[model samples]
Target: MSKVEDFEELRPLLFSIAYRILGSVSEAEDAVQETWLRFDGSATRPTSTKAYLSAAVTRISIDVLRSARVRRESYVGPWFPEPLLADPYEDPARSAELADSLSMAALLLLERLSPLERAVFVLREVFDFGFDDVAVAVGRSEAACRQLLVRARRHMAAGRPRFEADRQERQRLATRFLDALRNGDVGSLQSLLAADVQLVGDGGGKSPQLAKAVSGAENVARLLGTVFPWLVRIGVTFEPQEVNGQPGAIFRHRDGKILQVLVLDVLDGRIQTIRGVINPEKLDHLGPVADAWAADREVKQARREWG
Candidate 1:
């Protein structure tokens, strides 16, 4: 294949690496576009197109991440990676790993790692780039890259899931969990939430949301009873949909305005974290959800349709 064709074929991988490292869709897109510009204006064909493009994107992402971290530190309320629709990759295994890394919980954990470590981890773990390529991508020695990998792995492992839950079971639980909350069934919500469950909202101060993270199952449960009912009263409707590859609910105002997105992290068959992103800026990337989100469809039925 021609170099152009090769780069096109590998563009998805480049963007995935950049997005995992930066965790912002717009920055990732800009970095990819810049990478393409550099590739397109090259004076000579590189021996390996993948290596060249990957390095360019990773380095650009690292630059973007350095600034992103600072912005997030002062960000209002909670912060979340932009919710992505199913990523564009065609392979099943890669797509699955991408989903895991793109998850809000995983991204939050990643925030603790240094930018270099994040780049190394994304290239090596998420994209399965070889150490030699990772070294080139991050501008580190193979040995140094391995050390960064170890540190990144250790930091992320500290927050690893306690146990894997069945996907279908998790989805069923999410739907049921939302149902209980909507009906003001705090008792049922308490039963499904983990003891240390935490609920966080990212409203960016542009909308009304919890100012701080609320913890404890009882606290979150009581919170749902108070809040969900208010949303219902205000004509806000909820729909079950996949947010960042996890089962979550999106709230829309009666007029079809997107309100908030709730993404739950389940562990051992219970909800461990309730992540809500109401920041209109973050939801902009997910774009409009169509009129059906405002449709008065049953949550379970909607899950089947949107899932």
Candidate 2:
């Protein structure tokens, strides 16, 4: 493949790495765009496009992250990563690996690290890049990279287990949750939620959101019961999709407008947290879901008609 083609092929991985590091979709995308621009302007082709882009993005993200810290500190309320939906990959195993890279709680913990530490940890732990490669990516010596990884590991000691659910299991759980929501069955929905479940919504003030995180299983249950009934009344269609590597659902209106993207963080057998991103800015990358889900609706209708 040509350099451009190779870079295009690596875009998803690059975006994944940046998104995990930065949390904000816009910033991560900017980091990637800057990396591409630098690559395009380079005088000589690098021997390894992936390595070069990774390094470029990591370096750029470090710079962006520093600036982001100031903004985050000054922000109005708690900051949250933009939630995502997990769409299936052709290779289920590969999909599982990718999903691990997008977990919300995992990403939140990463914010505690320095930018370089975040890059090193993500490269070594998440991407499985060798210490030497990570060193080069972050402009550190191999020994320093190792030390950074150790520190980063300490920082993530309280993280959830890095277990990836099988495709069938994820799909089954997602379907159950969606059905419960459609039917306004709060009891069934509550059963699927973890006891310490957290519901975080990001409208970026563009759409409605809780002023603070609605935490605890009971509170989340109350909110869901109140909201789901209205959501169903509005004629929203829910589709199972992958977000941040876990089973998630997307809600769309009857007119095909994308309403929100729901990402779940499941622990053991129940969902430990829920992230709802209704921000139009964040939804832009998912493209026009209106037609996409409309087509899906049509297919389902045909099946029912035939049946």
Candidate 3:
């Protein structure tokens, strides 16, 4: 195959690696572009393009992660991985292990790991790379890479999901959630959410979001029904889509501008977590968003609509 064709074949894999490690779509795209540039200029080609490209993406992502953590330390609100319309990785269905590593919960857990640990985990567990390859990717010796893997696994295990998600069941719950959310049906919505359900919004301070992660089904439902009533109004639209191997939806305003892209974490047949990305900076790649919209519009909209 030609150089471009080879890159195209491995693009999804590379993108998945970078996205999982860096947790930013724009950054992942940039990393992949840089990888291509390097590949284009190289006079020598590796025997296995997949391994070479995967290593390049992994190393690039590790560098990005190291820098991103610094930026996130001072971020405005809770930082969330950029919402994905669809997972850009290996098919989770064909590989259950892949799903575990790419899920939102898993990615969040990964953020707690040091960059090397994260890289080691992604390469060894998620991508099934050999220790030597992982070592090369992270510039560590084989034994050091093995130690990193154990540490990463230990950290990840502490937060590992209780059970594998049932896709049909998760989708059913998400559909019910969207319906109740848009209908302003609090009782029904509450029924579908766990008592300790948590809702986390990422606005990066560029937009409005929960000042902190909101917990409890009542609080989350109240915020939807009373605080942000326009969410249930007729003008808004909801489109069901998969995000990071879980049931999710893309929400848009009456103006057809994307507003929120969300993912639901279903456990025990109810939504245990609700993650929404409303920051226009993150949503702009999906479509036109009011990038300049007021950060506190949730409060203003509530008053304007009610009054």
lDDT per residue (tens digit) for residues 1-307 in model 3? 9999999989998998888888888999999999999888889888888888888888888888888899999988887888776665666444888776667788889998999999889878887889978888889999999999999999999988653257788788888888788777788888988999999988887776777888998888887766444654435677888887788898777678787888888889888888988878788778798532542454466668775
Worst 10 residues of 1 by lDDT: 290-299
Decoy 3 TM-score against native: 0.92
> Rank by lDDT, descending?
1, 3, 2
Clashes of 2: 7
Clashes of 1: 0
lDDT of 1 by residue, 166-221 (tens): 78988999999989978989999999999999998877776667768999999999
Candidate 2, pairs of clashing residues? 84-243, 85-242, 85-243, 86-242, 86-243, 87-242, 99-245
The weakest ten consecutive residues by lDDT in model 3 span 290-299
> Over the full model, what C-alpha lDDT does candidate 1 score relative to the true structure?
0.81
Name the candidate, 1 or 2, with the larger lDDT value: 1
lDDT of 1 at 65: 93
Clash-forming residue pairs, model 1:
none
User: Each model's C-alpha lDDT?
Assistant: 0.81, 0.75, 0.81
Report lDDT (Cα) of residue 115, candidate 3: 92
